[model samples]
Target: MGCTTSRYATGKKKPVPIREIVVFVPSTRVPKEIDLRRPLRGSLSEGLLERLAALRAKVVALSEKWSLNCSTPTGNIATED
Candidate 1:
């Protein structure tokens, strides 16, 4: 992604010819999901729903492991903020 040549130039002198370089990154249209239930229905889109479900499954698995590792008064844990 580059070009080079001899006889370079510097400031206060003739400017060196410039070559352009470009980098590319691949991206997908995958969207993020946020869970919402009754009493507070979420504006979840179809694509987002799938992503949310996958994320929820992960959290459940992690919570199970964490609960076993550290027992506390609250059987499960939650965050208010």
Candidate 2:
């Protein structure tokens, strides 16, 4: 018998039919990483590059603040009067 055939005659449990499952996952396109050590090469406008740098600085500041808050001992702080 062919491999696809069920093995009912061998007194064994019949093999389950193979099924194809297609899952469609929606995802956002992420930009490729740019090496900050080197200068950017493109026709990108200077204004846009400045804006990006400002945003990066803001992100770094927020990250530092988050780390400081997390490192503090929350249990030792009195929450109520």
Candidate 3:
């Protein structure tokens, strides 16, 4: 008989150690081996407010689209007791 390669229609696997195992726990993680720098400009960041204001519409739209129920201390999202 000719030598046949391993693994056939019978779905048999050679005796080998299983390596694909992943365990995830909902626990906090700490940053490691990385560098983060501050803003390139000085303290008085120019045009930052305007840029954020421009994104407000998009953020609200996305929040409604995803049904996130996002609420903040703003007019449309916020409510007072």
Candidate 4:
């Protein structure tokens, strides 16, 4: 049996469990004075920019999916289990 205190009450009003997720993104610092007009051909900057774009897309998708899953009703989740 569960505790009877109001603080320990079970049901929809109960606090939802939470887990922290951390993602480390590697990056390099560039000087502000770097010439923007310079071409990126055959340089590490080109590859880094491409990888950043891909990571941004993946992060956006994951955020959307997590929001949907967390907002779902607990009853619906329990039934599916």
Candidate 5:
């Protein structure tokens, strides 16, 4: 899961050095799902559809455990603004 040195891979595929641990989670009340039932003209690519499905599943998993031990953000997120 990591390199030989104290470094972690992030963003791009290349390995890079990281100074500290960061937890990046979206903080917002779950939005209600609405099905507008919009039609599509052609079949979407299989890779795109697979990635979308994975994202949907991840959201569902996160939402289910979202209420358990939720903590208030204690630090400023903007490092340089």
Candidate 6:
């Protein structure tokens, strides 16, 4: 009998390479807290203000898109009073 080779592709031989990165932070450091309230004296820098506005817009958009009710607290999500 004669041997015939068919041109048919099989499963994926090489899978995607996933890298696990472990970051070890320093144990002790200066306590730096991010104050959410606006500056007492003057307005924040223009660049910072723009960034904060953009971030707020993104959050609102995401909440609307996923039908997430901000008032309803299901998990760790904060609810507005």
Candidate 2 TM-score to native: 0.43
Model 6 TM-score relative to the real fold? 0.32
Sliding window of 10 residues with minimal summed lDDT for model 5 = 34-43
TM-score of each: 0.34, 0.43, 0.25, 0.38, 0.34, 0.32
| Candidate 3 per-residue lDDT over residues 1-81, each given as its tens digit | 333343443555554333333343333332242212234235535576456545665665665644433332224433334
For candidate 4, write residues 1-81 as lDDT tens digits. 322333423656785433332334333222233332245445647777677557666666666666666555444232322
Q: Which scores better on lDDT, 5 or 6?
A: 5
Candidate 6 lDDT tens digits, 1-81: 333444334565554332332334333322244443366226677677767767766765665644544334455534444
Overall local distance difference test of candidate 2: 0.54
Superposition-based RMSD of candidate 2 using all C-alpha atoms, in angstroms: 16.5
Task: Please list the Cα RMSD from the true structure of every candidate, rounded to 1 decimal place.
Answer: 18.5, 16.5, 18.0, 12.5, 13.5, 17.4
Total residue pair clashes for candidate 5 = 0
Find the candidate with the highest TM-score and give its number.
2
**Model 6 misplaced regions, further than 4 Å:** 1-41, 68-81
Q: Whole-model lDDT for model 4 versus the true structure? A: 0.49
User: What are the lDDT figures for the candidates, one per model?
Assistant: 0.53, 0.54, 0.42, 0.49, 0.56, 0.49
Q: On lDDT, who's better, 1 or 3?
A: 1
Between prediction 3 and prediction 5, the one with superior lDDT is 5
Write the residue-wise lDDT of candidate 5 on 1-81 in tens digits. 333454446656666655455665656455466432233214666576667667766776777567443564466554432
Worst 10 residues of 3 by lDDT: 28-37
- Tell me the lDDT of candidate 3: 0.42
Q: What lDDT score is found at residue 46 in candidate 6?
A: 68
Residue 23's lDDT within candidate 1 is: 38
Residue pairs in clash, model 2: none
Tens digits of lDDT, candidate 2, 17-69: 43433334333233344544237537556777777877776766666676666
Backbone clashes, each candidate: 0, 0, 0, 0, 0, 0
